[model samples]
Target: MSFSASSPVSFVRAAVDGEIARFLDRRRAQLLEVGSELVPVADALEAMLAGGKRLRPAFCYWGWRGAGGADVAGIHAAAASLEFLQACALIHDDVIDNSDTRRGLPATHKRLESLHAASGWTGSAEAFGRGAAILIGDLCLAWSEDLYQASGLGPEALQTGRVPFDAMRTEVMAGQYLDMLEQVREDGGVEATLRVMHYKAAKYTVQRPLHLGAALAGRYDDLAPVYTDYGLPLGVAFQLRDDILGVFGDPEQTGKPAGDDLREGKRTLIVAETLERTGSADRAEFLRHLGDPLLSAETVEWMRGAAEDCGALAACERRIDDYVAQATAALETGRIDATARSALADLVVAATARKH
Candidate 1:
């Protein structure tokens, strides 16, 4: 049998994709009544949702299965609602970062900005794009709840998932504020940076999704602890890999410009570690160019070299391996459902070990 045949996540991804498409198709016409101009709003959302690996939904699906929930269509739709939450984050994040592209195309804000310019709108195109994108993000956040409420699960099941669903959204928004704060502070060191990762990626990306799924299964207490232990470390490793990619990944594969993170001056663990490992001169130069919007390729290359030469890059890689090992070990606990355990093992690898 194919690996997917036995994998809850693999099956749910396909199902969830169909559900989202159907949901958007119905909403598109309704939204057009507000204004024909608003059609592009939904268009940007559709495009953003199209290309992700659906990792959040995967974790949620397996979390439910691991907690003994059966594979039902209602649960699949509930699991798929996580993507709408993710879309909210990405749209707002792109606006905050002033990113030009996402998933190899113009970001939502950029697309809206282009729309303004092409139509001879009277205001600043940049301001219009930013405003429109924020509204889009808010709409996605609202629709996430709509999807969850309309998921057709039992009342109790929906109630169970609601707690984590609420917590996840609140925590991520707080984490996003922290991330913006870090960029402004002169020093956010490893400890502070990791704090952002924990709230932003660890909790928002994995732990809550898994908990939300387990809650939907009706006996979250059975697997909640195990899922937390597994999810947090794995989530951090996933973001760490993303940090590596943000600086060094192939632009085509990552769907963003090379060194975008460095250009934006994100206070990632990788950058923090590099400062600790490198000498004062290299550190000074790195900081000077860290947030430069017009940072040059030669300067980025030099900074990358400095980080590598100081052994920071190798250390970060080692940290990723260590976390992956911890996350994998959590699945071995005897309390876990056997079939779901195997699927989650595959998910651990998929979540952390990716080119994107």
Candidate 2:
């Protein structure tokens, strides 16, 4: 699966998905050798691995091409390894937020809890579920390293790519903690939300993946700033788009309940801006409903109306447009080859404009 820079985004996604599936299938066999109890572990991972948009790998692949790397299947495998890290982050995030569902299915903890209940061998199904999910998240984190090292690339390439790889994991964890802290801090504002968004989603989701690929191609020193210019703003726009969808998207499209982010009381830029723009009375009302576990459909609609009326949603949309403009300009002026630049330019729309 040696992809040219001209390869379609859909093609890249399919290739990475195939690599992930094959890699996990091999790992699943190895796990079963230990015992059948690990079957659930493998099954859960496999399920989680399904149906992602594969944006990280797409960025990585194009980054390699931009740096004048040869077309190679090994790069695809290395890029696909990032998916495991993403899975680890998502599983732990759900548990931390006490989320009910993900991608239209039970959150991993809830599913494990259900299994515990069905088996009738647990003191507390909820506890068992949470414990199992935590362990599984840990397992995915470990496997991310394993898959990257064994991605069929040489040791030198893997070693070269290690800096961004390690940094990405560390930053995402730190960002997630900051987000949790913001939830507790009653006066969380737009600046705090922006910081959390940058570390947790923006850099991890884009910049670092690009850096990892360029590093592997031996051009990291030259391309680092260019990648940052293109990736950072675009990544922020992408996450902002996601935040919008989390609040206003259809459940069938987003795979989570409507207002899930609101329910979790995430300090998203949208929420922060909306709070700032609302009248004092309306702001007070918003806070009362912010993190209510039993929030109602009617109230969710009211919150949507409040967000719109306050101009927060429009403001956020303008911010996304501005960031995207910045990134698009970077793509034009940056020192990247034509084919790779075109490929990357194609990705900007897909990343920020997706429904889910």
Candidate 3:
């Protein structure tokens, strides 16, 4: 039942992709049978599920293996369910951030907006797009639940998985609201921003996946604390890396414009640090241009240099390394099988080492 670092990554990817395709195919037929009018919505859902790297599913699979679960079918289904949840989140996230692209394709909202405009649909194109995207996101959420219910886990496993899923969804929604609130609040300082990052990105992205995987393996009592020990620090590192890539990664690889995070005014730890360390003039300039969607490449380069010059990037790197070390140390404390532990450790490295 154990997997090597190299094999697990590939196996997890294949399993998740297969499960997602199967789920989508079945759901597409069901939606079509419901009515012709729901076709676009179904297509949007499928598109949103397309072309993801499936990292969340990998995390779930490895976590289950680490907890000594041997049922590949059960683990695959659970992992696929996580992907569905992720699709729901991403679709809504793009709408909230007003992002135009995902995975190098038009975002759900943008695609819907384009269709509305081209078809000369009655009502404002923007409103129609947002409404359609919202419905698509909701559909994904419903399918997420349905898929999880059909994961073929026993009743006992379902009881365990439900706890983390419920908490994860609730906390993520709250985190999303908090994120929006932070962008507008005059008094939202560095602390507030960090809190939002923990709730919105860290816990939901890494911690919850680990918890769900462990729950599926019926090792919640033994592995829940391990999630805190390993997931929290790793989750933070993951987001810090994401923030770095959002501002600096190649647009082709990241599937978004450079400085997109800056344009969205994401209240990341790096941004908070930059705000704290920069001088008054530079700080004023940064604040003025922080969320301006019209930012040029030159301005983004300047902001990047400013972040490095003010020690924000260096500090963020140090923090990432610290978390990586913490996760490594926690792995030593865990009593999982050596092979499973090795796979999870490799995952920690892979997740944190990515450039995009």
Candidate 4:
């Protein structure tokens, strides 16, 4: 649907979508010359990009605008580049999480697995699926860089943005490793949870995107700290909302099966708080099925009950509320464009409080 009529953010979202679609169409045509078999990679990438709130681009666009950058086609393309980066992260994340679906459709790896099974491929469908997904994720990462470079900014401006762009990729990879380590160890409490959120979600999702936009507009030195002040809290709040949705949100809205995070044994603040507050029996029950792939719906509901009974859900909600307050406060910092500030205030709410 055309989101241009909804709001300023929606206009940015629609513009970003248009840029991404054009980029993918161009890429798909180029891939066709390689081989028909290669077309599925583009298809997977296209499908993955089709459904998202475009929040990263929205943040980037507003960041640029807040930095006194003109509203221009170049900034839109630059902002849209975050979508490709996000695609890379999502494809790789789904593989690592063993997620079956994303954006309410089979994940890239899962889709490939089904394709292999349907075609009666000669090898293990699981392995083939994973391998294909890895390559596709890499392709998206590479394309993200290309689009960033070609965002129509001058060489110096692109170079300015490159600093955060490079750092973001590195930080996200490290964050993913830390996340895996948390799953394996399964004992980090609130501190660990916040650290993971900082790298994995906060910086990568919001701060860096904002920095990239500001940098491209030649305002990095002045605005980087301000963006961080605004972006980090909002970003963490965004992920916390995601964690809540992973447990409590409807499948129709969240685009994942119920309790998928619980199935994955994510060491979220919710899990940590529940463990801290529950009685021994309730804690044991939660731990018993914390990471079980075979957890029944009844067990999932039971865990949800235990979380609520122990006040973990309420605690998480309180934290989100505080972070939202902090984020909204940060936007009032000196010298930001008034229009951008207002839109960003709206974004703080939209990012932190949502069904999906």
Quote model 3's TM-score.
Answer: 0.95
List, residue by residue over 126-191, the lDDT tens digit for candidate 3: 888888898888888888888888988898998888998889889889999998888787467668
Candidate 2 lDDT by residue in tens digits, 108-176: 899899988998984999999999999999988998888888888889989999999999999999999
Residue clash pairs of candidate 4: none
Backbone clash pairs for candidate 3 read none
Write the candidate numbers in order of decreasing lDDT: 2, 4, 1, 3
Candidate 2: residue 116 lDDT (0-100): 88
In candidate 2, position 264 carries an lDDT of 83
lDDT of 1 by residue, 1-356 (tens): 22442254566779999889988887788799888988889898899889788888988888888888898888878988889999999999999998888888999999999999999989799999999999999988888999899989999999989889899999999999999998898677888989999999999888999999899988688788999999999999989999998888888889887888889888888899999989999899899999888888898898788878998888889989999999999989987678778888887778777788
- Candidate 4 regions off by >4 Å? 1-8
Off by over 4 Å in 3: 1-7
Model 1 sits at a Cα RMSD from the real structure of 1.6
TM-score, predicted candidate 4 vs. hidden true structure: 0.97
Score candidate 1 by TM-score against the native: 0.97
> lDDT scores for all predictions?
0.88, 0.88, 0.83, 0.88
For every model shown, the clashing-pair count is 0, 1, 0, 0
Q: Which ten residues in a row are the worst by lDDT in model 1?
A: 1-10
**Deviating ranges (above 4 Å) for candidate 2:** 1-8
